[model samples]
Target: MRPARQTALEKVLPQIAIESPEAALDFPFTPEKVWLEIGFGNGDALAHWHHEFPNTGFIGCEPFINGVSNFCKLVANDDLKNIRIWNDIAQPLMAALPDASIDRVYLLNSDPWPKKRHHRRRVIQQESLDTLWRIMKPGALLILTTDHQSLAEWMLEQTLRHSKFEWTAKCKADWQTPPEGWLTTRYEGKGAVAGRSQVYLTFRKVDCE
Candidate 1:
């Protein structure tokens, strides 16, 4: 992290850092819903969502030091009070959170791990989906977006195989276009500039007895 970013993180850590799962977030107002964004690169979407939905509490997880610093800077500069961050992988954090606590989850433009051997390392795996299902409320939305064709197919296949989720797309346009109130991210912009089209997949958590 840069010196300025380090300093910024230091000042905002106490307020935005999620020290432990046991610690309750002190939101300025009672949030009607809670959202989680995994691997929020540079936090562009997270910040946009926070700005758009001020009453919804947001928890963002990013293992990269630079990304965390950038998110912290956004939180500080905007005085965003409804956001918390986990500067680490999301699995453990998801485990610690109360069951069915999260209303929505965003996994956008995640690392594709294009090589065949490294597909196991992709974020949208069976185990991770189980964890996500455990944390998400019934009928909650799990939004996934990727510019990589292989990754988009992999995500759809994995989620479709999981009985807990249902694809919400009615037609090709639904998956090809951005959803309502969608916020563009830096990575998505790069993909667009490269003439690579993206896919937006939304899955709903099914109510299972």
Candidate 2:
């Protein structure tokens, strides 16, 4: 972690970090809705969303220390009151959350883990989706974006294989373009500069019959 960010995290984390499942239940202010962002690299989108939805509480999980520090700096600088941080793996945090707790989730430009042997390390897998399905409220949205073609297909296939989710895209443009009010991240900007297209996929959690 950078020195400045580390210092900022030390000061702000005690106030904004969600330490346990019990804390998450009443995070920040217990707003009408809760959103989760896993692997919020550098926190540009997370901060943007928090700014846009002051009434909704946000829980952002990032295992990388640098990212966590940067995110903490944003929270401190903006004095964003409705956001909480989990500076650890998302699975444990997900497990800590109660059933039907999350209203929205963002998994954007996650590490592709391109190697075949490393595919299991990718976040958009069966187990992760199953947990997400369990925690998400009925009709809640899961928004995923990736510039890697294989990863995009993998996400689509994994989500489609799960019976709990329904794809919201009716046409190509729906996935081709970023969703309305989209907050573009640094990684997304780099992908665009490289002429690589990013896919935006939204899946709605549904009740299982």
TM-score of each: 0.94, 0.95
lDDT (10s digit) by residue, model 2, range 1-209 = 67889898898888888787557756656588999999998999998888889889899988888887887787777756788888788888898788899999999999999999999999988999989999999999999999999999999999999878999999999999999888899999999999999999999998885
How would you encode candidate 1's per-residue C-alpha lDDT over 1-209 as one tens digit per residue?
78888987888767788887654344667789999999998999998888888889999889997988877777777766888888888878887887888999999999999999999999999999998998899899999999999999999999999878999999999999999777889999999999999999999999885
Model 1 C-alpha lDDT versus the unseen true structure = 0.88
Instruction: Please give the CA lDDT of all the candidate structures.
Output: 0.88, 0.89
Look at candidate 1 and tell me the lDDT of residue 178. Answer: 99
Worst 10 residues of 2 by lDDT: 21-30
Task: Give the CA lDDT, 0 to 100, for residue 37 in model 1.
Answer: 94
Cα-based lDDT at residue 119, candidate 2: 95
